[model samples]
Every structure is written in C-alpha cells, then in structure tokens.
Target: MTSHTVQIKLNGSPLSLETSKVAKQADGAVVVRFGGTMVLSTVVAARGPMEGRDFLPLTVEYREKAYAGGKIPGGFFKREGRPDEKETLTCRLIDRPIRPLFPKGFRNEIQVINLVISADNENDPDVLAMVGTSAALSLSGIPFEGPLGAVRVCMVDGKLVVNPTYAQQSTATLEIVMAATEDAVLMVEAGGKEIGEEQMLEALAFGHEQCKQLVRIQKELMTQAAKPRWAFDAKEGLDSGLLEKVRQIATPRVVEALAIHQKQARAEAIAAAFEATWAHLVTVDHVADDAATRVKTQEYFEKVEKTEVRRLIVDKGIRVDGRSVKEVRPIWSEIGYLPRAHGSALFTRGETQALVATTLGTKNDEQKIESFEGDIYRTFMLHYNFPPFSTGEVKRFGTAGRREIGHGALAHRAISAVLPSKEAFPYTIRVVSEILESNGSSSMATVCGASMSLMDAGVPLAAPVAGIAMGLVKEGDKVGILTDIMGTEDHYGDMDFKVAGTEKGITALQMDIKIGGVSVDIMRQALAQAREARIHVLGKMAEAIKAPKATLSEFAPRFVTIKIRPEKIREIIGPGGKVIRGIQEKTGAKIDVEDDGKVTVFSSSAEKAQQTIDIIQDICREAELDRIYLGKVKSIKEFGAFVEIMQGTEGLLHISQIAETRIRAVSDVLTEGDEVLVKVIEIDGNGKIRLSRKQALRDQPALSDKEKLKIVPASAAGA
Candidate 1:
C-alpha cells in the first residue's frame, strides 16, 4: 500500500494528514489527526450532473462512533441511530462554508462524509472535520473553487486562545468557529458573553489568521496529491431572445406585485404574472412539447424574478414588504400566556410568530449528551419546532429535521450567553419555541420569544437579547442592506446574516452568503445596523415584561444547594444509595449529589426542601457536645433506654438520667415508641453518644409569658 503523509505544527500541536492509505477506492479521501483525535473525511462526486438537475445536490454527514471514545452506543438498538443534534449542527458547519465554494451552475451530486474514528476526550474533531473535508475536496477531480480552512477560537481569562481543548472551552467566555480564505472570512458561528462588536471582530480576525496557515498547508498537500480534472459538458444558458422576451413581459408586472405589502396577496399576484408569461411562451410555435416548455419557462421565470428583485432593492431600495432599507417589521410580545408553564411568551414580528415556553426542572431533567466527547449534561436547552401549519402547507409530520436542529442551536447560542450561573439559578431550564407563523426570520423571532420567556420564568439573565436578520442585494457597485429581511429577500439576496445580542454587545452571530464572499466593511455595517434593530426589538419586549419576574411561579419547584466534604459524599449516599433514598422518601424531595460534594435538593414546598437539607446535614454532620436533639426512644431495659438522635446516630439514656425525679423502671418513663428531648452529654473515644434527658430539661430556659400563653388549652383561652 502506498502512503503519503504531511505534518505541520498548528497552535503548538502537530497536525498530520495522510492519504492513499485508507479508503483508496473513493474519489478523494484523507485522514487528519490533531493531538490524539483522528477524523477520516472523504469526498465523491458523480461523473456528470443528473438529468433535470438545476441546483447543486450536496450532502454532508458527520458521525461519531461510540468506540471512538472507548464507549458503547446507548439505547435499545445498541447501535448508532439517527443523527443527534450535535451531529446535525456539525453537518451544517461543514456544509455552509463549502457549499458556496462550488462552481456556479454546477449541479453535480457531491457527498462529503466525516467520521470520528478516534477521540482524545479533550480535543474535539468537528473543527478538524471541516479542514479535512476541505482537503479531500481540494484533491478531488471535481471543479471546486479552491481550498479554504476552518478554526475554533476561544477567549480564556482575558486572552485569546486558538484551538482550545474541551477543558479550556468550559471556562472560556467566548467561542467562535470561523471559515475563511487567506484574506476574507466566508462563514462565522459564535457565542460570547456579551462581547463588544470590536472584540468579536478581533476574534474573527484571529481565527482567520489561523485559517491562513491551514490554507497554506492544504495548498502544499494539494501540490503533491491532486487528481486529474473530470470532463463534463456545462449546461447552456437561455437564448438571448427568450431571456429578453421573458424580461419584457414580467419586469413591470413583478415590480407592481412586489410593491404590495400583504404577503399572500403579493404572492398570488407574482404567481399570476409568471404563469401568464409562461403561457405566452408555451404557445410559441417553436416550443417542442408541453413538458419541455414548462421546464424552460419555469427556469426563465426564476431568473427574471431574481433580476427584478435585485433591481428593486439595489436601485429603488424597496423591499417586497414595502419597508424601508433599515426598517424592522412591527413587533408584539407577551409573557405568562400559559398558566401552567414556568415561563411562557408569544412574540410576533411582521408575519412571523413564535410561541415560546420555558419549563423549570431539577437536575434529573437535564439532557444527557453521550458522544465521543464523553458524557455531558446540558442544563439549558432550546428546542425549535416548525409545524407544516406555520407556513400554511399540508405536509407529512416527522421529528426535527436538519433545519430545526440548526435553528434551535442558533437560538440556544444567543440565549445561553446571558443565562445566570448554575450557582445563582439551580433549576434546569428548557425552552421550546413553536413556530405558529413564518415568512421571514422566524429563527430570530424564536430568539426574541425565548429571551422573554426565560425572563418570565424568573431566570436572572445578565441582559435581555434580541436577534435580527440582515440581507444584502448587490448590483454592480451599488449595495443595499436590508434589515429584518423576509423569505423573498433571503432567497434572492446575496447574503443572509443573522445577528443576535443584548444592548451591551453581541452574544451570537451566523452568516451564510450565496456570493463568493462579503467584504469586512459590509459585515461591520451589518453588525451596527443589527444592533440598532436589536435595541428596538428589546424595547418592545420590555413593554411586555420589562425584566424577569421577581419570583418563580408558585407551581415551579424550589431548589436549595448545600456543600459537604467530598469524603462525606459516599456516607450520605450510603451503601447502594440506601441513605439518600431514605431522605428523599421521607421528605419528598429530589436530590442530586455531585462528585464535588455539592448537594442540591428540589421540592415543590420550600419547607420540604429545608427538611431534606436537614436530613442530609444530619447524615454528614459530626456529633457535637452539648447540643440537644428530639430523639426517638429505641428500647426499654433495666439499666437504660437507647434513643436515636439523628439519622444513623444513637445515644444511651441511663435510667438515672431519664427524668427529673426517680423512676421505678425505664419503661415507665421512656418507651420504645415515645419521643423525648436529650442532650449529648459526652462523646466517647469510639464515637458513641451519651445522652441525659434530665440534664436536657434542667438546662432548658424558663418560658416567658408569651411562650406560656401559647401552651394554654383552647377552651381555657376562650373562657
């Protein structure tokens, strides 16, 4: 077997790329290793474009094998099932930046597969997956627009760290994944702790710098390991006469239809105009057949619409919704709409509507992520659901698709930055955003609704966050920036930039463009405009509920946290969890004990929570001298009676110390079923407790008038 390897030093670590040694039959394949993590990325394209294909059919899949982390798959199937959320998001991460790099009008069926074959449990392979996919595609014979690189940047302890390990990411205030060429950034996905725009820009620059090194490395590898170019005939464009005819017929009609503010009405008008033009073209004597005519006319009409939309935006600065370039749609928000939910909010922006609800739960409710990175518990989760009814369509219902996962992740990143620390808010939080209506920027609406709902649940967020989607239409030198863009602009525009942040700074931002790349200055301007719109949306949200509610809902569970010595964790848990289970059963509380000895108790009643805490405390607490306990009598004997003072603690009460006066027998004064107050008179060398009921009563202070009156019988008090 022939083997070729190239090694480079990146971020103080050695990265090795090997090809011609694995998956040799594939069109192009490479295995990349960083630290101890390894990923195999392979790319293949069909010999020629499929018939009737008008768009690039590209699919990217990222899978994690349980054995990569020295574990086994979980669930009834005991093997890998459908793609999880992380995997789905990773697929998007690989697809977004590379999708634009393919040649224009290239309709080949291309597939890229990334597999995590090995994991170090510290460094994640997702970033490496992107770089490897790029390398594989660069080596393929298919016509790709050259190679780019991806990198992960993190801000740790007031300093920027490139390619940080999982441990460092846990403490980093900012995390960003950037895809770029040597000069310009093509894609960015980031979440920050209210980081200012300048800082975010700096991070992007840092990431891009790292990407340059990787891009150079890829170039070197490509020089030695490139395949011969494939042969395929490019599809021909429409004839000039046909294009001119369609333009002349549809331009004026499309212009008038786009000016209508109502979505459904405008849609019908545009469809009617296109259908009329199509009918005219089909009736031409040169048209060969009905099916062929329909296809040609449909494609031509799309081109016409694209031309008209760009002209309207870049020349007239007019949007389909009739809003100005920078104007945001109308917004209305309300919280506490669901009485049973811990927090709930409904937010509507123009035509998009999101009903978001937040549910508070104990630690047991946290979502467990079992992956090659090891087990992780997610305490804050945001789920996005898009029903067919949201878009006024009739479609088959199924689980969350790739779009839902990606949108939910964006919203999660935007809101997670402002959430309070676990120590401040102990309840596990889950936010679900249901799209009731969608036209433009429903994901941004989800972000707004989630923020309002989180606050409604009394989650002391650092600041309220809002999101806005920005669009760009470029014609020649003139460029128009559309804020709060709708679905039509997103389809025909050059860029779809979604910016989310608080008033202080940005928390998250995701950008994907259909063009080659966007200039940095344009990105800066977009950020500034998005900030203004975000503040405006926040104002509307504040009117609904200015801040998080002062208190949690009455139905929500109350949580209390306490710290204990690590050594005592086992003692509290007992053998086979006997002691902890007993405490839960007795007090009706949910208990979560961490390895670090931080015990959190959750209960509907604050009183029960405190009671559970007391039980755990007694189990772990050391016996103290001179302290008294209301203990249970355990036995009757001639010499003394033994009393159970605390959980698993016993003290001997001698007959002589049973009461203030002499007693004939221990049974007369203290029976096994009776309760009595006893003082810890002494603790012996063996940790045994010595109790005295007489001394406990003797040391008790005399009751005052108020205390004495409380003991009066009801009949005597009334008389």
Candidate 2:
C-alpha cells in the first residue's frame, strides 16, 4: 500500500492528513491528526438513487472508541452500544456544514463515518473529523462542491485562538465552529458569554480566514488524490409541460390558500387544491398508472408551492400567516404552569407551543459523561422532545432523532449562557421541553420557555434569554429577510438563521444557508431583525416573571452546605460509611461528601436538613477548654456521674465537683436521664473530658481566699 501525507502549520500546530493506507475499499478515506489526536473519516455513496428518494439521503456518524483514550469500556456489555450525547452532537457539527455543500439535485444515498482512533485529552477530535470528512469527500468521485474547511475558534483572555486545546476552551469566553468555502461561510455553531455582535462577527471572520488556509491544503491534496467524477441521474425531474398544466389548474386555489392566516385551514385548503388538480389530470387528461400519477402530482405541486411562497414573500412582501417581512408572530407565556415541578412554563407563539419543565437536583444528580477525553459531569442539561402529534401526524415514537438532539443542544447552549456558575448555584439542573404544537421554530420557543421555567424555579439566572428564527427569500434583485418564520416559510426559504441571546448580546447562534452562499450584508440584516424579535419575546417573558423567586418552592428539596477540614472527611464518613449513613438514616436527609470536605445535605424538610447539619457538627466537634454544655447523666457512678455532652462524647462529673457540698453519694445530686449544666474544666491527653458542675454553679468569685476558708459546706455543718 502506498501512503500519501500532507502536513501544514495550522494555527501554530502541525496538521497532518494521510490516506491510501487503510479503508481502501471506501469511496474516499483520510486520516487527520493534530497533536496526539487522530480521526479516520470515510465517505461511501450508493451507485444509484433509491427508487422514490426525493431529498439528499445523507447520514453522518461520529463515534468515539473507549480505547481512543486508553480506557476499557465501562458498561455491562463492555462494548459501545448506541451513540452517546457527545457522539450525536459531534455528528451534527460535521453534518450541518457538509450537508449544504452537496449538489442540490444529487440524491444518491451517502454515508459519512468518522471515528476517533486516538485521543490525547488535550486536542479535540470533533474538528479533526470535520476537516478529514471534507477532504475525503473532496477526493471522492462524487459530485461534491469542492473543498470546505472547518475550524474551532475561541477567545481566551481577549486573544483569539484557532483550534485551541480542550483546556483552553474551558476558560474561553467564546467558542464557535465555523465551516466555509473560500468565498463565503456556509455554517456556524457558536456559544458565547454574552459576546457582542461585532465581536462575534470578528470571531467569525477570524475563523473563516483560518478555514481559507485549510481549504488551500485540502485543494492541494485533492490535486494528487482526486478520482474521476461519477455521473448520476438528477434526483428530481421537472416536467415543464406537465408542471405548467398543474400550475394552470392550481394557481388560483394556491393563491387563495396562501392568503389564509390560519395554518390548519390553509393546509386543508392546499391539500384540497392538490387533490382536485390530481383528479382532473388523471380523469380528464388521461394520465396513466396509479403510482406514477401519484408521484408526479405530489412532485409538481411541491414545486408550485415553493415558487408561490418565495414569489409572494420576495415580490409581494407577503407571508402565509399574513405577517409582513420582519414581523414576529403573537407571543404569550405563563410561569408556574406545573406546581409539581421545580420550575415550569408554557410559552406559545402563534401556532408553536412548548411546555418546559425545570428540575434542580444535588450533586448526585449530575449527568456522568464517560467519553474519550475522560469522565466528566454535566451540571446543566436541556432535552427537547418532539412528539408526532405536535405536527398533527401519527407515527411511531422512539429514541431522540438527530433533529431533536440538534435542537436540544442549541437550546441548551442558549440557556446555559445565562445559568449561574456551579459554585454559585450548587445544584444540578435539567430542563425538558415538550413540544405540544409546532408550526415554526419550536426550538426557539423551547429556548424562551426554558429561561422562564428556570427563573420560575428560583434559579438566579444572569439574564433572561430568547430565541428567534429568521428566514430569507431572494428572487433576481428582490430580497426579503423574515423574522419569526413559520414552518411553511422555513421549508420554502433559502436560509434558516436562528439567533438566541439576552438583551445585552448574543449567547448562541446557529445558521445554515441552503443556497450557495449569502453575503455578510444579508446576515447583518437578519441578525438585526432577529434581535428585535428576541427583545420583543423577552419582554413578553418578563411580564410573566421579572425575576427568579426569592425562595425555592415549598415542595422543592432544601439544601444546606457545610465545610470541614479535608482530613476530617474520612471521620464523618467513618470506616465503612457508618457515620454518614447513620446521619442520613436518622435525619431523613441525603448527604453527599466531597473530597474537599464540602458536604451538602438535601431534604424535603428544612428542619431535617438543619438536624442533619447539627448531627454532622457534633460528630466533628472537639472539646473546648472553657465551653459549657447542657449534658445528660448517662449513669451514676461512685466517683462521679458519667454525663453525655454530645452524641458519643462523655465526661466525668466527679462527686466533689457535682455540688458545693460534701455529698454522701454520687447519686445524691444526679441520676440517670437527668439533665444538668456543667463546664468542661479539663481534657486529658487521652481525650478524656472532666466536667465541673460546681464551677458552672458559681456566678461570683468567693469573697476572698480568707472568706472561702471561713465558709463551711452544708453537708459538713449538718453532720
């Protein structure tokens, strides 16, 4: 086997691409390496399109092997099962940018697989997979739009770093993955700490410049490794004559249907028009086979729908919902929707609705992520669920799909920017968004609802976040930018730009351009329009709950944290967790002890939490020289009475110290189960405590040494 390697200096680091040594049977394959991390990417495409496939049947999979990080698989099966969340998310990171680069009319089944073969824990594999996938596709004979570059840019301490290390990303204020060609940026996924628009724009520009350099390297590799292009039939055939016939019969009704403001009614009207036109064509025009006519009619009607929607928006400045360009739909929200949840809200915008619920838990509740990098815990999580009924359809429901994961991650990024630091909040948070009805950007609605639900749950968020989905339509010279686009506009438009942020600045932004490329000027306008919509939505959310409640709900668990010496952690935990377990069992509270000696107690009752704290304090308490205690008499002895000061702590109350008299016996003044005040006079070297009731009883010093000598004990005088 012959090996070809391409090496270049990328952002102060060596980037290497090698191929022709492995996976030779695949259409295209390459291995990319940076630092010690490596990823193998391969692209495979079917020879011909599926029988009825109308869209690009492309799938991207990113998998991380346990051995990549030199670790054994952890589960019972001892092998990887389904893709974890990180793998799923990385798939999206690669798919979004590359999917748009495919030719529009090519529909052959294509699959791109990326595997992290090695991980050094410092460098990340996701970006490597992206660049490798692009190179593989470019080298393949498939008719792909050549050479796109992907880069991860981060701002650390006011300095921009391209492809930063994982450690640096943890401290960076802005992290974004941008994909672009030499001329324009095709995709972006970003999350920032309330970074301003201009700063974010600058970061994008920096990333794009880096992408240009990588693109150059890929182009050079393609020159040496490129294969002959394969020819395939167009996925969709436009029959002009038949299309015109359907348009003539359906244009009037399509126009009427587009004018209706109600989504369902308009959908019904459009369906009826399509049915009527199909019936006329089959019966009156003598259209042939049953299956052939069905396919032809559906295809023709969709084209007609696309043309009408785009023309109406770009030329007539009309939307199917009767809103003008840059106009947002009506929005309403309510908090405290579910009393049982820690926090809950229902946010509705036009026909889109989300019922979001937030739950707060202790450290034990954090999601454990065992990945190639290492085991890590996530404190904040947002999950989005899209039931088929939300779209007025009936279908089998199973695990979350790519769309659901992508949307949830987007919402998670948006809301996470405003979440309090782990040190400040000290609780694990989970937000679940259930889409009850969806016509347009339900993901954006989830963002708004998540923010409201968090605030309602008494989470002290930095600020409220809102999201808006924008769309674009361009015909010749006429161009229109839309705000708060619905499902119809999104499906027919050329751009789906989602902007999420606070009133001050953007936190998360994702854009995917379906067309070749969009100018920066168009993006600027879209961002400005989306900002307006976001502000309007935030204002509506503010009316529901301006701030987080001052206190957690009565039903929510109460948390109390305490700090002790690190060395004492084992003491509280005891030899076999006996001490801590006993405390939990006795106080009815859950306790989590950390290595740093930080103990957090969680309980439904505040009193129980406090009681657990008291128990812990007693367990860790030390005897002071001059402190007083209200101890109980555990037993009566000849020399003194054994008094229990605190749990497991006992002191000797000598007969002479029991009172200011010569007591005949120790039981004369004290009995078992009797409570008495005493002072800790001394603690021996062996940790034995000596208590003095006589010293505690004396409020004033004896008159003087002589006066004390003159004084007589009551028992002695009586004898």
- Angstrom error at residue 80, model 1: 2.7
Task: Name the runs in model 1 displaced over 4 angstroms.
Answer: 237-244, 284-286, 562-574, 595-597, 614-630, 635-642, 652-672, 676-682, 690-719
Cα-lDDT of candidate 2: 0.87
In candidate 1, list every pair of residues with a backbone clash: none
TM-score for each predicted model, relative to the true structure: 0.90, 0.90
The TM-score obtained by model 1 is: 0.90
Model 1 scores what on Cα lDDT? 0.86
Off by over 4 Å in 2: 233-238, 626-645, 648-719
- Candidate 2 per-residue lDDT over residues 1-719, each given as its tens digit: 67788888766789998888899899999999998899999999999866676679999999998888888887799987899888998998898888877776687899999999899898889989999999999888898886888889999999999999888988999999988999988899999988888888889989989999889988888878878888755544757778788888888878888889999899999999899888888888877648766787787888888899998888889888888997888888899999899999999999999999999888889999886556799999899999999989999798899899999999999998889887678888999999999999999999999999999999999999999999989887788999999999999898889999999999999998887778788888888888888889889889999888888877778899999888768768887888888888998888988888888899989999999999888867887887877777888889998988886578998999887879999866666777776789999998999999777656324522333332233343345
Model 1 Cα shift for residue 163 (angstroms): 1.8
Expressed as tens digits, the lDDT of each residue in 194-238 for candidate 1 is 988888888888888889888888888888888987765444554
TM-score of 2: 0.90
The lDDT per prediction is 0.86, 0.87
Worst 10 residues of 2 by lDDT: 703-712
